[model samples]
Structures are given as structure tokens and as C-alpha cells.
Target: MPFALYLLGLAVFAMGTSEFMLSGLIPDIASDLRVSVPAAGALTSAFAAGMIVGAPLTAALSMRWPRRRALLAFLVSFLLLHVLGAVTTSFEVLLATRFAGAVANAGFLAVAVATAAAMAPPEAKGRATSILLGGVTLACVAGVPAGAVLGTMWGWRSAFWAVALLSVPAVVAVLRSVPATPAPTGGGGGARREARALRDPRLLMLLVLAALVNGATFCTFTYLAPLATSVGGIAPGWVPGLLVLFGLGSFAGVTAAGRLADTRPRPLLAAGGVALVAGWAVLGAAAGSPVAVAVLVLTQGALSFAVGSTLVSQVLYAATQAPTLAGSFATAAFNVGAAAGPWLGGITIGAGLGYRSPVWVSASLVAAALAVAATAHVTGRGPTSPDASRLQQTLP
Candidate 1:
């Protein structure tokens, strides 16, 4: 892989850390701001909301600009927003900063995926995407925990400051390593072009697939801390360690999936879906068993991310006519799922279903995605080989 790909991953790491660290800081934020925990938790929802809007909006706005310049602009905004977050005194100000930061993060991610796809050999596009997204999984493994520790020792603001500092190096890396490529020619109005590109049924199916799969994963993931403590009878102190284990599994899954993505994405997708369903089932059944909970967290994380990168690759392949917009839509779809999962899980908990209820909810969503994948395969609309897709796109 190119060094630029790794730099993109580093950029993702900074963004992912900022995006996720808020979960750990909610309690502190609630206390410091004199608000309810749920209100502080809304900060997370605010960020996701920003992402849902920003991805497509940014993609459309930047459609005519060089990818490198768009990416750099987004990073500059991202860095500044984190600084704003660090300095904000009022909860409302902090929430606004989080939303702004997410907008920048969404733009950065959408462009990064498109740029990575453009940079890689067609045969290696999947691996290239994996390399770029690996930063996210790495954040889960390393950055979130470290931010939590930093926040606990100093203050929540410290974590934002750290992310701001991290973005400085990421900006430098992109300026040095990533080349500026001109936007594609023969463009109609950007909005019309993107709208027309989204008309493809295969692309739409892939977007739905992204949403369902991501929703399934987050349904369980958003409640893991409570489930670990209340259901598995684990100590609260052990929650962070369990999250690290989950991250390690995710890292391993994405790495392995990248190796097979170019040639065997369909099988990989099917297998990942099945594995996720099975993992959730086992987790629900063994919710009270600490050993089983630990094992299943790791298993679920691996299966979830294995499906994630493959889904992104499939969307990119299907959206050859509008790669950047497709990338934005995929990001938006994933955030939609991310936001929906926790809300649904919260409803289940409110209705008196135990914390383990999220496991079943996730399983059902993944099963739906599996059914869609099967339908696509049976109907001959599954992702094509990269070489074949390129040939088809080139034909008059």
C-alpha cells in the first residue's frame, strides 16, 4: 500500500478518536455542565446528526474541487473545532463544537474513501480502503481508552486538546504525502450528477446494506458497558479492558478481510453476516456468564468490522459513475444506522427487556442484511470483479 494510504488512516484515527471519546466523557460532562446524563449523551447524537448531514452536503459542495484540497480543508476545520470544544465553557457551546467537528470529520472521511479508491490499483481497492479505515478500528483499540484515561486524570477538555494536537500532524502528513488530483471532467451540475448516479438500484441496495449492518452492530455495541456490568456481573473497572478486546478483534477482522476482499467479497460478506448473527445469539443466551460475554464481545466485533469494509468496497464498486457521492451516501447510511441502533436499544431497555435485548435486535438487523445480500447474489446484482467493473465502465 502507498504511504499516503497510511496517512489517510492516521487522519481517520484522529477523527475517530474525537468522534468516540465523547462516550467516555459524558458523565464528566454532565457533572461539569450541571445537566442530566442523557442530555450530555445527546452530544453524541448531535455529532452523528452532523455526520448524516455533512457527508452528502460536503461531497456535493466539493465535487468540483481537487480531492487533496477538499481533504485538507476538512482537516483544518476538524482541528479548529476540536480546539473550540476544548475551550467551550457552556454545554451548548460544547455541543455546537461537537456538531461542527463531526461535519468536518464526515467530509474528511467521505473524501478519504474516494481518494483511496482512486489511488489504488483496481485489484487492490478493497485493501486500500481497509488500510484507510483501519485507523478507526485502531482508535477503538488505542485512542478511545487513552482519551478516557486522559480525561479522568486531567479533564474532559484535555481529550479534545489531545485530538486537536493529533490533527496537526495529520494535516502535515496529508500535505506532504497525498497528491492533488483534479476533479473528474464532463460534470453537469454536481447535485444533478450525484442524484442521477444514486438512481442505480445496485448502489441503493448497497447503501441499505451499509445501514442495516451498521445498525445491527451498534445496537449491541452502544449498550455493552451496561450489559457487561449488569448482565455479565463484571466489575465496572473491567469495562475498558473488554472494549480493548473488542477493538483487537475488530482490527484482526478488518485486516484479514482486506486480504480477501478483492477476490472473495461475496463469500466474506455472507460469512461475516452469519458469524455476527451467531455471535449475537450466543451473547444473548450467555449474557450472565462473564467468560462467554468476553468471548462473544470479541467475536461480534470481528464479524461486524469484517462486514463493514467489504460493504464500503461494494458500494464504491457499484457507484463507479459517482464515487465521491457514493462515498458520502455510504457514510450517511452508516451514521443513520449508528444513531438508530442505540435509540432502538434504549427503547427495548425501557420496555423492560434486559440489556441482552440489544443482542437479539442486532441479530435481526444482520439477518435482514444477510437476506438482502442473498437476494442480490441470486439475482446477479452482487458486486462484480474490479477488472470486470472497469471494463464495463469504459465501454461506450
Candidate 2:
């Protein structure tokens, strides 16, 4: 698991950074391409929408291949997509590239957790999963910021070129480093197998939790820049630095969740959920001032995503019988949040609620997520435990 996760982490890092780097590089892109800022914004949104559409489709079709082959294929597609994205000169082409790129990226993530979980020690699955997923948290903290710096000094095209270069190495590393695990797909009737997976209450609960968590986190994240500028009145120069604060906290949470999941996922999930509510509440009240708002957002990002990482791992563990389906569903839940959160936030803002509207709304959703987690605990019929997995193996 050690070297395998490390290799997976490398691919994760490359993909995570490339995906997020576009956000920071938009201004440069807009100017170079002679497009409006919002037009540039479409680049990021296209990627998100692609993930939403591609997750389940990729998982379903790729079921016949072993996990290694599937993962490798996804990464190769990802690398090709980035190359396509890098070569785009017009808006429509860029949008198409991002859409395809995102699908490839999402498919890669769906495979990563399943592959890592298979390699992990029985009780340390959380740690393995976290280490692989940590690339995203790290991207926020390190990759995007560095890419931003690269884009600013050299021009935005350099960012995509850099991503393309990184992908080549990642492909080689995965090919050489990741151990080949037999595909989790099997000999049964695929239709009956899917039906059984659908009936698992534990999986249903996990998807519910994932959607809730993403719904809440993304609600505010979508409007973070404007909210900070309008409500907190932070100057333009300080926005990037403030993002760094949030990224740092995310890194800390990612590291912590890895071990915390192994010790006790439910309690950790509950605690992180509570922290998300409190964190967003603090953000809501503090958005009136620059200093306080930055502090609160940093805290909020760290806690919310920490819980999210744990929640995803929890779902994978719960659906051990159908890891491929579960992994893809995890991505599906994330997009559900991504799509709903911003739509809801936009509605709240358009209602004349002002810049702080998303903060207030997201906070309430986080609070609801906490309530959902608590309800699950009380019911004792929620997300499946490892003990509930259909795959039987003697514990080490």
C-alpha cells in the first residue's frame, strides 16, 4: 500500500493541480484570448459539468477491465484531454476540451479510491484513501498557487503546457509503480449485481451524506471571491493570499482525516460536520470585516473538506461489495452538491440578500449536514461499516 499509494498520489497531484490551476489562470487567459472574464469563467464550469456527466458512465463501461487497466486508461485519456485543452485557441474548443478533460479526470478519481482501498491494510483503508486524495488538498495549498505564479510571469498557456508535461511523468509512474490488482468486476450477472448494490442501505446513506457535504461546502465556495470583496471589502491583491489560507487548512484536514477515519469514521464525520457548521457560521458573521472573514473562511475550508474526504472513504468502505459503483457514485454526489450549491446561492443573492447571502445559506446547509450525520448515528442504520462488507477476508 505504501509505494502504491505514493505512486497514485503522484497522478492525483498532477490531475488535481491541472484541474484547479485554470481558475487562477483565467485573467491571463481572458486577456490573451480577448474574451470577457465570465467567458473565461466558463472554462472552469465546463470541467465541473463534465465530471457530473462522466462519472457513472465511465464506471459502468469500464467494469470489464481490471482496476489497473481502467485507471491507466483514464489517466491516458486525461493526459490527452489536457493536451487538447492546451492547444485550444477559441472559446468553443476550450469548452469542449475542458468538458472532455473533466470527464477523464472524474473517471480517474473514481478509479483511484477503489484501487487504493484494495491495496490498503484492512483497518487502514482510510489512510490509504486519504493519501491518494490528498493531492487535491495539496493542489489547493501548493499546486494552484504555484501555477498561478507561473501563469502570471509567463502567460496562462504555460500553465496548461506545464500540466501536459506533468501528465507524461504521471503516466509513466503509474505504469511502472502501481501494482496490478485484479479488476474488482466479476463473473456474476452484471444486472443482478447492480440491483444488489442498489439495495444496500449503507451505500444509500453514504451517497446522502456526500451530497449534503458537497452541497454545503460549494454553496459558499462558488461565491467566495465576490463575497470577500463586496462584504469583507478585501482589496483585489489580498484575495489570492486569503485563498492560500483556506488551502492550508484544507491540507491539514486532509492529513488528519486519513488517520481519523481508521480510528472512528462516524465520530470523526460527526465532529467534522459540527465544525463545518460552526466554521460557516463564523464566516457568515465575520464577512462584514476583512480580517475576520479571511480567518473564518480558512477555518471553514479546512474543516468542511476534511469531513468530505472521510465521508468519501466511508462510502467506499461501506460498499465494499460494489466498490466501482460506489466510487463512481461518490463523484456523482460531489457534482450534485456542486450543481445545487451555486444555484441555491445564486437564488439567495438574487433575492436582494446581498453579498453575504451565500455565507448564510451555506452555513444553514452545513448545519443541516450536521443534523443528518447525527440522525444517522441515532438510527444505527446508516452508511455501511467495514464489518458489513460482502467481501470476506480475515483481519490481519
Best TM-score goes to which candidate? 1
Itemize residue pairs with steric clashes in candidate 2.
none
Per residue, candidate 2 scores C-alpha lDDT tens digits across 1-396 of 568788888888888898778767888888877899989888877877888888877877677777778888998888877777677788778788888988888888887777787777776777877897788777777888889888888878777878778878888887887777665546345524753776776677778778878887788877888988888888877777877887888878888888677666767777777777777777787787888887887777778778888888887777766766777888888878877888799899899998788877887877777676667768886544664243224423
Evaluate all candidate structures by whole-model CA lDDT and list the values in order.
0.87, 0.78
Model 1 clashing-pair count: 0
Provide the clashing-pair count of each candidate structure: 0, 0
TM-score of each: 0.96, 0.91
Q: Name model 1 segments beyond 4 Å from true.
A: 186-188, 386-396
- Mind giving the per-residue lDDT tens digits that candidate 1 earns over 1-396? 888999999999999888888868999999988999999999999999999999988877778788889999999999998898788789999989888889989999998998998889877778987897799999999999999999999989899999999999999999999997787554447656766878887888888888998998888888999999999999999999988988888888889888877777777888788988888988999999999999988888888988998888888888887877777988999999999988888899999998999889999898998898789889887755666455446657
Predictions: Cα RMSD each: 3.0, 3.1
- List residue ranges in candidate 2 displaced over 4 A: 184-192, 387-396
